[model samples]
Target: MKKQRYALIIIDMQNDFVLPDSPACVAGALATVAQIQKILETCRRIKWPVIHVIREYRADGSDIEITRLPEFREKKYCVPGTAGCEIVAALKPASDEYIIVKKRFSAFMNTELDIILRRLEIENIVICGTQYPHCIRATVYDGVSYGYNVTLITDATAAQTPEIASANTRDIRDIGVECVSTFYFVNNIAVH
Candidate 1:
């Protein structure tokens, strides 16, 4: 595949999801942020499209339905325009990069991600994000549905458990997506 025609999507690498004290933080999520940054730097240097997706909820807890999770609704997390919803400092995106705000686990749901990718003429996607089973996996499926060659960067993503990660990786590959390590993907691109 042509690496130049691909984009790097960094999903939900936010404070509330990576920080230990945050309400919805995942374990070791922060560990992969540096790796993700390195990927972003390389992509930027090569002028590849970079898209960052973030989850945002309403502060008053009004946008979030308590019925979805009675316990979670009470917690103030990822409120729209809040600090917790902001992406981590280490992966500061450039001004020209695309920033996608998604309300649900699927980044393409009710979002212009598909349209943007189409506009960019992107045929393949390199996904690197947090919460593998949730947003990252969902996005990968969506990418395939949109006719993009999707590659999951395992080292740049994290989940609640190893089992979940392994299962998601297997599932994604089962559907024709390529699950690869960040280093391997980068090396292949370099060789290409």
Candidate 2:
């Protein structure tokens, strides 16, 4: 059998989204930090490629989406040179890991994520990170659409509420993406 090439894509784990006190905080995001850390450690140990996908918007809101423009302009977050735009310290990328800056929800949308994965010859993508309804869901869908075997670490990905997380997990699973816990993934999938 041909070996399965895997990569870990961590989406939108920036201070703006993961910090509880931040303006753009996702309620459940802070809780997933330890779980995401576990996954990150495992990936680093196993020598799998790790990609941190962060969201950034122009301070002027000129590049933000139409629906979000008003809010973004009123309360700026994820702008360059701001602490909120940086990836959370615990999950910061190592020197060799990849960091992708995305302006939109989906990491693959207008980003170098797809091409980087292709260049790495990655066939299986393990995804984790915040806000299930938007960034996480969109990236998972696009990962599948891009013809990669996508796996979601349920405990490591977050949404504003448990209901939203569960609902999105169900929808993602319905599309045939593997949804498993951090423990399960590290013990089973990542081992091989």
Identify the candidate with maximal TM-score. Answer: 2
lDDT of 2 at 111: 93
The lDDT for every candidate, in the order shown, is 0.84, 0.94
Those runs of model 2 whose alpha carbons end farther than 4 Å from true positions after fitting are none
Q: Write the per-residue lDDT of candidate 1 for residues 145-190, one digit (tens) a residue.
A: 8788888888889988888888888998899888888788778852
TM-score of 1: 0.92
Clashes of 1: 0
Tens-digit per-residue lDDT, 75-132, candidate 2: 8999999999999999989999999998888999999999999999999999999889
Q: Name the 10 consecutive residues with the lowest summed lDDT in model 2.
A: 65-74
Q: On a 0 to 100 scale, what is the lDDT of residue 120 in model 1?
A: 90
Each prediction's Cα RMSD?
2.1, 0.7
